[model samples]
Target: MAELSADAAWNYVYCQGWNRDLQRFVGLLDSDTACARNEAGEQYSVTLLRGGVPRVVIDIAWSAHYLGVWTLDEALRRDSHVDYRRLRAEQLFPVRERVWRYAEGQRDGDDDVWEQEVSRKANGWMSTSKRPRGRLGGSSRTAGQEDDTDIWREVPVFGDWRWALPDKEAGPVGTAAEHTGEYEAVSAGSPWRPPTPYRNLYLDDLMLEGATVLMEGAQPRVVAHRLRGMVDMPTGQVITCEPRWLDYSEPFTDTIEPGRYEVHDVLLTDPDSESDWWPRAGFLLRVSEAPVVSWEMALRAGEDPRTLSDGDFYGFSGSQGCFVDAEPLRTADHQINADRGREQSYALRKWARMAKRGELHEHPHSQWSDALERGLDDRDGIRLPGTNFNMIAYNCYYPDGSYPTWIGRATDGAIVCFLTDMRTTHPVIATDH
Candidate 1:
């Protein structure tokens, strides 16, 4: 390909559907990846691809509604060896025809790339391929020796640990053992007591040494959910862990960190509704950036049916009365006007900062904090498109201490995303819920 000419340097702006304020605002909203997420109940089911590393699982309370999203909140990457890069491919189907550029140290180059277009029709499958030219065909990797799934993480100041996420812990905050069922109720009047401003709430980044987890055993029936950090407030330390599930009721709740912990549970919920529709990870995660925070986890199978997707973070387990959302759940009251008073971009940042400031020490209402417009937890929410576990959710809180919620919605309406195959609509009944 020869270099282009200056005459062909066509440059101009083209506007197609543009007219009034409604359309303009709608357009703005469309570009918002944030909105695509947290659209509660628009779709149900999140699937981690067959190659999803580490583990996959999430849990949202079935009774929650209004605003809930499959949130991929809070991620940070520190400089390290084994130079790595993350590519966010925006496409209708990146398996073949993609929407954007090939990221990550160039998954490929100008060199020939193999193109296999597969389709399903009736009881048969179809595949059209554009084989690579000469040596550009298959990679040098051998059978079963494909991609390397290794990661590293470093702690961040004010950042809490998150096990579920592939990142390191940031701060020292973890839930207490046993379901107190009183995180929200306790000191809802004025229960804030943050660390002193002089405290070393450094915004420094610690380097994460790369490590490996060798599973040397008969691979047990695996069930992995994202992890939340554990912090012993008494000692001001943070730790990240990946806890395994034993049974339904008494799953292992090991504290990687010692000492007593005060439960400051951060959930992915709507800002204004009674409760979120999804099963939030009960006890996990750390505070980040003083203002924002994140919560991670999924899955809780029920005995009624074993219909759980890979990384089913919010589904219930055991033989109890299990319920699934029949249709895409929807909810209002994600972030109220009061929450977004006018200044804050996200509500979580304000809430976290205030919490650290001891604002809620006496009463939640007294320490009530609100933001102008933003989420309670400010972290990049993870999302997997086209796959079954393609979920997106986020939330914000009202300083006035109302039942916090999120601005959430799902793209896969009633679709069940899981391993094995692609998306399959798994409609759940709201009545049972």
Candidate 2:
């Protein structure tokens, strides 16, 4: 075994159980009475005891990016007094007024309708709540943000921000074909196993053969569609979007070269119910010709990807299909609003045409209405007037959920592409070397 550094030894003692080497290391501090004990719970605690009394405690919680140290008194007080429910309630109290204003406008004085609308909106907000977990604390202080309170001083972990030991040997990294056998074997008995006649789509295949044109009523277990326009990455910063939405989308902190890239939409054709449409499985934005050899989560500025919990993602909000584009979608507010107005007008015109042609009633009970709301013309892609940016939208899996984007890199660490994982099909094996 290699000799551990002081920080490594300390982390080993707190994260793993104490061994002879760790015990000897701890002896240097105070051999007589100093000892450490691990107490695992929803939050793992490592208590440092002196004369059988807890003096210091180290805590590591699920999804927490750092290890926290607290005095025994501080830990006891927090554990006994902090009420997450009360905190959550306080946090959401201010949202009621805003929700009411919007709901009231839509309700038109119907108390039941108003209440129901409020409840629905409130519940939706609660479901996607980004409240901090594990401990009661303020956010880290930034230029315009409040400073974090000194409840528990945080310490960064040594290796990966995941706070776990690094893998001894790196996993294999290659194209989809090289890993398909392993993926099939692992997914054979899993819930996410692909159905019979399933086909896995790839960027190379799509670019070479063009999108698989679907006939009306034709359903393939898996399919891919080429987004009709090129994405402009003028500043290299990228953001995802649901083309139909007029809202501004936030960009990921990381960037690629300032250039244009091709976009592709991947989807699962079979829906959970007959009324629903095919939902998004993932997206591919080819950034370079280099083959991807590894992947990492695409996070916003100052956000650490390793701290994200399972099922958690860092992507744009979606109600319809989503696309990728460069930041500063429009240069001026007037231009942005004008583009939005045009989309709205286009949608209204299309709906009117469909209604006049008797096409609206064809899928009356189906979720195809959602697609109509996005405008039929935007099904392939949409380029804003007087702008180089283009949006390639597609239906989201079931219409809504937070999807995560992964940065695919070449063996030499150059970015090859970006993938927005909607189905959670990819394996977690990428390592930082």
Candidate 3:
């Protein structure tokens, strides 16, 4: 096992989570604690500490989401090597004014249209705190320490900020080919499998040929128009493909481009509902060479509700005088629903930040570029220069909730986020590696 030096010890703790009671970031202190070897004879240990004091020890070698101890160190070394001061600092938006404007603006520009709304707090019309939670940068100070630069001076993180991809598709539906995979045939337990409509039809029956162009008219025609799956986006259409074949007998020369066409149709397969299941159901397939990366994060309030300022509110807000100031937040009545609205707000903020920093690996397609252009002012939605964390704060109307998502590297050197508001903030470690 590799011995931990001062820098190595710092890397381990810097990627872990922050300890609220300790009043400082937490991480592993020494290298000897990580000497325990797994069945593979690999040394692995993840110890979280508060001010060089051990708090929680996780044996990541044999635990879930294990990527080996060496990987953890490599990621940490890469993240810590960068001089954050040298990188261009991101500009921060005026969050308080934006949320206030949204709250004050009526549905139809009239006062009584939606009058029950109000701002949560009037404090700090602009939360200009250089650091998160009014605390100094990570690795700056410890619990009892006085000097800001006494603990450490560098911003410890894991490699350049990159988007981690999901392990599997978000949807549950699978195709016939997936059912016939080697694992599916030998698996012991049976899952509640949804029937694939095209399971009966095998690939041989479809007789799909590779790139067989049938005609070359104004709109080039193809032998088979592949109908994958459908995706629903905010502005227009988002589509997903599952290898289903659809026959495009009619001439789509007018609507489609010159390239190969992938035609899709809106289908309703819900048996439970007597009414039409395809109410406003739509199908759109937009294929682009431009790359796309997707990931998910659980968002939550990190600081005490009382300490949060007006700028903390991100997306939507209530009116200034009409709504209860702190009742919603204090009573936990304003928690953002992760599945419904939080994801949309997160994607908005994340992509905007990535684009502005020029860290986005894949060049966005025209559609995505257009969407980003529309929200350009949000380039620094919940982030500031020199701060170790990136945040995504927004509000939803129907559910009447506010979401302040915190994203940052922990002392342990993992890219993680704090989703929910507990007495202590726990890092939801990202496992894309």
The numbered model that scores best in TM-score is 2
| Location of the lowest summed lDDT over 10 successive residues in candidate 1 | 199-208
Best candidate (score: lDDT): 2
What lDDT does candidate 1 reach at residue 56? 16
Can you write out model 3's per-residue Cα lDDT over 166-212, one digit (the tens) per residue? 12211121110111111112222211111111111111111222322
lDDT leaderboard ranking: 2, 3, 1
Q: Lowest summed-lDDT stretch of 10 residues in model 3?
A: 78-87
Q: Which lDDT tens digits does candidate 1 get at residues 288-355? A: 21322221122122211112112222222221111111111111111122344455566567667777
lDDT tens readout by residue for model 2, 281-332 = 5777888877666767777764543333233455666765544545545442
In lDDT terms, how accurate is model 1?
A: 0.21
lDDT of each: 0.21, 0.40, 0.23
Q: What are the models' TM-scores?
A: 0.16, 0.46, 0.19
lDDT, residue 97, candidate 2: 14
Q: How many backbone clashes does candidate 1 have?
A: 113
**Ranked by TM-score, top first:** 2, 3, 1
